[model samples]
Target: MGTRGLVAAMALMLCFGVDRVVSDASDHRYKAGDPVPLYANKVGPFHNPSETYRYYDLPFCSPEHVKEKSEALGEVLNGDRLVDAPYKLDFRVDIDSKLVCKKKLTKEDVSQFRTAVTKDYYFQMYYDDLPIWGFIGKVDREGKTDPSEFKYFLFKHINFDVLYNNDRVIEINAYTDPNALVDITEDQDIEVEFFYSVKWKETTTPFEKRMEKYSQTSSLPHHLEIHWFSIINSCVTVLLLTGFLATILMRVLKNDFVKYTHDEESAEDQEETGWKYIHGDVFRFPTNKSLFAACIGSGTQLFALTVFIFILALVGVFYPYNRGALFTALVVIYALTSGIAGYVATNFYCQLEGTNWVRNLLLTGCLFCGPLFLNFCFLNTVAIVYSSTAALPFGTILVILLIWTLVTSPLLVLGGIAGKNSNVEFQAPCRTTKYPREIPPLPWYRGTIPQMAMAGFLPFSAIYIELYYIFASVWGHKIYTIYSILFIVFIILLIVTAFITIALTYFQLAAEDHQWWWRALLCGGSTGLFIYGYCWYYYYARSDMSGFMQTSFFFGYMACICYGFFLMLGTVGFRAALFFVRHIYRSIKCE
Candidate 1:
């Protein structure tokens, strides 16, 4: 390219960058109607930060005007009307502010209202048709109404005058209320409009009105945009941790834990017990099958719930971008999971070669019902505190509890019984571990805590940034978009759990960590602890999420319980797979 052309292109790029910033501040173009930010953080315990501005019509209407308008409407309709007593102008506002950015309001935006008594254009009022309302800014150049004390009755009629300062823009809303409409009805109708105007300043240097355009992606609520770049940024530290710990586990399992020497007397005793005694005792294998059952049960429940929600989104049951819908869905889904958990766990436990039926039933009940009860308590407390209609009442909670205990819980037990009584066969391919060789402890590698904790970190790291963004939208009052990204991240989490499980198990086995099953389970699930920590940091330190720790009790408890459940599942799954592998190896040797 010519030097002149290259220079022109660079100049254009610079000019475009500057213009893009300016345009963002000045742009009033809404994809539909006025471009208004529609979502807000959930109103917490102490205060509902959300505020609204109302602009009513001017002029005091006497009793005569009300009578005349009533007569006019009745005359227009004649006697064939739908039960109308008088021409009374009614104004109503129902605001719901705790919506995510991707959400939409159920109600349509309010149209301009014209009153019969006051014919002036400025007497119109603007209203939000949707339940959710967010106040952007109020403008009043008239000295009567101060910006400090926004006059709600006199503030809804005018278009916003947007003033740009530095990189930010300010939108000024204006309106007025008149006393003439007092005799018209109990209330009056006022019209409101949302409009934006741009203001640019000029200094000494001759500046041209730079015209440039650029494209930026917008967001919706509870949606994440996970890209390769995002993976690189978020997962690097997690992957590093996994790889390093995996090596340590391998070393501990092989070099330190499994090396055992059998004396001549012990060898003879083993020979007397037959071939099974050659390597070790038969009962030495830890009861690790439960771990597998836990993971499969939890994983299945999570899979089903996520699919149900996104499918609902696709079908517009809750509407993809509405915050209230999202909250409602979350609560409903959590309640539904009790049944799923009970059924899966009961069925799996029955399949295991265990004899204690009572133990199995109790375990299943605790696994499924415990979390539900905790969630219920938290939700009820919040509902009472906020006086939110969204909260299920105590009676409803009791009913749900009854249904779970009577219907879902019993069904699981029945399923378990059926499964146990079935003639299904699961023969191990081989039983490699002959003796229940006592594995020495390794602080960093052995036991449930370290392994489970380590496993919990991988999936959380994969989407940490995305999670941060989601929290911001919910609590920090930022906009969220890109549902597709969240779907992909959910998939990534599943894959991560599976892959880390397989990899850690193999590594442990190679180290001859005969206790590979439990270790592997821990490796998959421990990452949840990392997520919980992130949540704490985000809620307490990083963001301005206040009062929510107590008021958003239901969701908070649900999140914790969910994290624990997944962690347990991942840990148990690894152990189950390791147990089956060991069983198969031993069986093959006997054959």
Candidate 2:
């Protein structure tokens, strides 16, 4: 209870929870005298997930030769930096008190404790593969505090509460007693002792349900309400787009077709400036067809990936508490699904009479992976500089590379070969001209930028609210469990993107632009721009997240997400536009 002394122990609390993706590397079926180990992981300020450091870096009385336990791939990616601890614990056993170590605190040690307490750092550790977090210490400060009024206190002793069921370790909890606090106000070298106690309790709860309690009290809200407003907004978006497309197909396009087909108007008086009149150039395949095809292919693959993940998640393949289950699935599935991208891209390229099959295939393979690799390297460098847990080890990086090389590459090549040999061709109703007709000066709304903006707005509106929750889970240490609503929003986003893109394509063709291929893709993908804008806004609002490593991590992550959106939505829109253009031109007579 002294105001001037060296710190005995420091307790830290973490917002987000962690779980062993694989088991804790120990056989949980322990006999009566089995020794249970408590492994210490990284520590960081509770507010910043990317800002993390090794727990032993805090000058804790760790073992003389501290050794780190090997972690699974998923565990490392989730930022686990495990180090051996000196405390002794055993399964199905209890100890009243344990003296970890006694050491004389140097000036540097006292300063370290003061900084950690002021920053409100948290400690992470694993016992029986279950993660437990505690705040290192607490700071008592007066309102608008003067420097003289701030008092820093470190929790000297920690108590572990273990709940086991059916002889299997189930849940873990760590607590700091208020009476066991040491103040670190004095600047001189002081003596300190770090001690801990353990209590083992038998519980009836099943092993599978052990993580249930942590789920209820993480950074996210325990009680989830149905997001009715977002769902209703999505529904409205669907209706609005459906009505607009219906009107264009049933009314406007109908009138335009009827005029040139039936009315034998004079050449001077005929509407020479409409979609029906530009049939020859409408299907003329946009410039940079290979790049365009690559985008489409990549997007198709991403779409497939999304659906596959949703199905798997619905079947309960991914347990929420499994720290890296979702991530592992994403990497593996994305790699295995490379064939989808290769085949789709090859088909589109052949349809446009593309010559360089190899180049196209290469581009398709690099579509997402290229940018992702570059971004990862940049952020990883920053993480290494900060000695943060967010930095990936070389072994993990090699594993990812091997997955892509051994699995993803061969599948992609096989797919490309299949598509190339099939010899697909574009079946245009009207023959495209050797040269494109001159496009007349169009109104402002008919421009590509305007059309893309209009095309993206409806789809972006549908998912904007859902994105907030998703962002919170990724960056704000919140857990999102409403996959049903997420899938609904996803479906709605795709439909709206397609319909809106079709509408824009029709307008561009109506304005006599004739180049609908890339327009539709760009227009549909513009939703990514809107999402990226929201990313910027979120960064500004969360200004406490400063420093180079954390900033790069956030933006790099968001860039990949936005790029995927662009590909997925853009492909959806392009397909819809292609279908509309083919159907309309086939139905009408063009002389």
Candidate 3:
């Protein structure tokens, strides 16, 4: 009852927590003539999401009193810092050309603008709860063949086209006029007037579908493209692998089972061969059982988290690449599922005859989060040094720490206590012998390393195509909104991993290798190494990313992600091998 109640509570929180969040500044719909707040978000090279600075970091006009919109947890975590803009836009109001400000540019100001233009920097703004994006300046080539003839011009005139349904905003678009371009190719002092115009139009689109326009914008990274060929190819590969497993592995195991059952009376006279010989040692607990159990528990929790978020995404709770929305859900869901980790780790550790429950509990909590903290801290330091908006503020760090200390700690304790009280015993089909058996040496091909390398390739090959799209969405300006395809690929990855691990474990046991516990787990996780290798390839061959800021952010977070994949896939493989060993050993006649 207690566990059920807690799960129910967490589910409710996950469902309702989104509604309670307020990313937009407006609390209520405004009437006509009421000034709507326009907020400036961040400025960065359009190609790179991580290399962002505050909008005001550039030499833009600032208001007399700097005011900012109150942000939610999602907003803060997404690196969003929304401040009041200089533009005055009212709901459903048309305004002529109005001068925002006229300022004399210093040499330093011109240099800054020139640098921004060179990098193709763009700015983001929010008007009436709708996000708007525009490039700060444009680069022009006077002579296509000559690098010296290239020129940079800043966009001084701001034009906003806002579409609204009767009382609500449907969309907002920002545009630049060619006549208003200010030449800034050379360092020269010039007076510039920033002018803005707002035109409101009525749209037939309902308020509910306002976010649809974002998907239509070519300027935004909301393009939802599904590589049908790649997806189909992956599907075919996985199907073949599954067919092989079903026909060959299953048939081989079946023949062994029948032969052993029928020839039990002659077994004592014949010398022991194959996996049956090591039945007594197959279930021996691996070294450092507590840590291994914690990793499995963390992996289980991550698997659950993956499913939950993908379901939410599929059901349209939110779309992909909406950083604020997606990031918040991940954080909230991960913490809520911490209890599962504690329960699984504690239970598994207890079954291993581990006496120190407290140490096991702490290991369960720290297994994944500890390394993640170090990774985040290193990335944050880089962001700070570069003065990028990607850095987490002091307040946001406190919030995360508080969540771990107050929320995660208590729930983990509750789950651990429940797991301890359950008192489940480890059940082995064959009794472990008091004296250890000397195992026979194997050939190079049968070695643990060779098995892992071979076992991991099948799974990695099955999903390598989808892996490209995923990497593009994360490190590049691509939006991946194909949840159904993603779900299919995820299932394929897990299935291939399980079957491959099972096949490898069976081969090892047949070779009289009783030390299969860690080998099976690692065999499943080796896919991460391939994935990390792909990351490097994509960085060099696929993406246009450069510079220290973006480079550090990309590799740092990606390493952590690859580690997570290792643990998740490893857990799946380990569980499958364990099930296979128990079933085969339990069925065959053994002394």
lDDT of candidate 1 over 1-591, digit per residue (tens): 001111111111101000011112134223312333211112111121111111111121112332111111111111110111111111111122211112111112111211221211221111111112223222323565554442222222122222222322222222222321112211334333322222233223211211100001233222223444575565566567657866775574344222222323244333322222323333233474554454455555555555776666455343222223443344345445545554565556556665565565566555534554565466545544544323443554465456555655565566556656654644444443544555444556645575566556677777787777655544433444445666776666666676567655554544445555456656666665666667677766665434452325423543645454454446445545556455434432332
Q: How many clashes (backbone atoms < 3 Å, residues ≥3 apart in a chain or on different chains) does model 1 have?
A: 63
Candidate 3 minimal-lDDT segment of 10 residues: 1-10
Instruction: Write down the RMSD of candidate 2 (Cα, Å).
Output: 6.3
Query: How close is every model to the real structure, measured as TM-score?
Result: 0.54, 0.90, 0.93
Cα distance off (Å), candidate 2, residue 276: 0.4
In order, what is each prediction's RMSD in angstroms?
16.6, 6.3, 5.0
- Ten residues in a row with the worst lDDT in model 2? 2-11
Tens digits of lDDT, candidate 3, 1-591: 001111111222221134333334446366787777778988888767678888899989998788877776666666678898889888888987889899799989999999889888989877765777899999898558675678889999988898877777777888998889899988889999999998999889987677665545422433333466667877897778678776898888898887777677665677677898888888889999988999888888888877887888788876532435665676677778889888988998999899898899999988888877786788788888988877878987798788877777787888888878789999898998776678897899988788888988988888888888766656655556667877988898898899889888998998899999999899999998888888899889988878887777777777777778888899999999999899999888788
lDDT of each: 0.40, 0.75, 0.78
Candidate 2, residues 422-510, lDDT tens digits: the string is 88787889988899999888788777888878888888888888887777667655666667778888888888888888877877887
Ranked by lDDT, top first = 3, 2, 1
- Residue 172 of model 3 has an lDDT of 83
